[model samples]
Target: MSVDNFCETISDQINTGILVVSLDFTIVKWNRFLQVHANVTPEKVLGKCIFDVFPELPKKWFERKLSSVIQLGTQSFCSWEQRHHLFELPHTRPITTDSHFMAQNCTFLPITSDNVITHICILIEDATDVCHYQTMLNKTLESLAMANRIDGLTQIFNRKHWEECLAKEFSRARRYNHGLALIMFDLDHFKLLNDTYGHLGGDKVLVETSKTIQSLLRLCDQFGRYGGEEFAIVLPETDLVGAADVAERIRAAIEGTDINFQDQIIRTSVSVGVSIINSQDKRYEDLIQNADNALYKAKSSGRNRVCLSTELP
Candidate 1:
């Protein structure tokens, strides 16, 4: 086989775009891979200057590097990790491919004759698929993160998410010198209710309670089930008085109605503890403990009452 036929055979078998250009950046040859990748046929692109055909090619960038290749006969390679050449392609070509089609790796080799640069060989490898898969993997990880923060039963924020949310709100409140209120509460004799009725009936009460509390809350409020039969609420921009008022409203709502569980009417009440932000408290445990203390006060005084942390005196 002749040398020309061998080169054609090699070009046709390769997946990478292979092309040759003159020292002036005029296309001297374009292989079949280049034709498919570029969507430009040899007849149209041959003998044409690179910028004249793709006018958006960064003139300054190419002028700087191409001048070096021409003058110094330096063979250079560019990785997609550094910059993307996808923008250089026609908009139609980009859209026809999937979102993952942005990998662009190219090598520039200067063919020298007697220490003078005569022609340059360009090789391009398409890595768009690899990049697309990476983006999809990242999105999957994000979804997992969201799922980990949700409670399995009520599909609300779980305890871990509650802590994260409280920390962020605490920072915001301290920065703005605004009020932050925390309410802690538990069902009165939850163990008795669970024992008298089965675990399923207790679950019904918990679910209904979540709904009731959520209805009373604003969009900015954050609530989470603290533990078995216990829950907590974080209210940003609310003072201690405001927190107590909200807690009473919750207690009243719980006691005002009976939850229907398998033909039995279950009556229940909640003991609440309320606190307002006075200083920059970093950990949620301290605020939770304070609320628990107030809740203990309410439980001791009367199971259905609301107690405030500041009302300890």
Candidate 2:
């Protein structure tokens, strides 16, 4: 076949909108892709001003963009990311897409005559599928980031995120010289409980305990799973006395509630250690260490009780 015929064949078969416009902005050529999708034949659009044909287009911005391409004799391009579409043409997949019309990537190429620019060939490509995949990927990334912040089993803050919160609370309390407290608690005889009822029973007890503690906490409290059968809470604006009261309340609540697992009744208790920020406390870890020390005292003396850091020494 001849070169001109082959080029025409390629342009006709390719599935993208193509149009050529003269210096006066008159539509000179329209490809089959545009003919089918835009539902306007070449006979009607040819020799007609583009602005007259499509009145909804942003005339000023388009004129400026086209002027630059003509003067510089270089190609120009625009994506759907900037503005949605160059034409108000109806897209083919209306049933599936949420979009009202087609999203487009428009390219303006200078068509030269005898080494001088004369007309511009505009190519319009549908970016609907690309936009769809990008949106899905963004949602997936958001879900992953959220999962990182929460524990998979209990749905509370995970160790890393909870520690981050603790550090921030510590800074705020120290800066403002306000009150703050930390509570570290362990389920008493957890190993024995697990052995008696299997890991599944222990899991249920942990899940239920987390829910119960959450229900009792104020909005300022931050809870997290420290490790297996162990948990921690950061109570903002809480003093030593108030911290002790909070610890005791959590202890009694857990002791009172009966957890049912595998159609069998099970019971568990927590040994809690409470500590408040003091003038001598150098860092956030110091507060956690003090609470841990009190927890050891609670466990050593007896399980199912609360211990205060101030009473330790």
Query: CA RMSD for every model?
Result: 5.3, 4.8
lDDT of 2 by residue, 10-89 (tens): 99889788899999999999999999888888999999999998899899998999999999989999998787788987
Give one digit per residue, the lDDT tens place, for model 1 in 27-145. Answer: 88888877765688899999999778768667788667767777777877777667666335422336545643447778888888897778888877776665556657878999898
TM-score of each candidate structure, all chains considered together: 0.68, 0.70
State candidate 2's TM-score: 0.70
Error (Å) of candidate 2 at residue 73 is 9.1
How high is the CA lDDT of each candidate model? 0.81, 0.92
lDDT of model 1, residue 62: 67
Superposed model 2: Cα runs more than 4 Å off: 1-11, 19-30, 42-103, 107-122, 168-180, 217-221, 236-249, 310-313
lDDT of 1 at 182: 97
- Which clashing pairs does model 2 show? none
What is candidate 2's local distance difference test score? 0.92
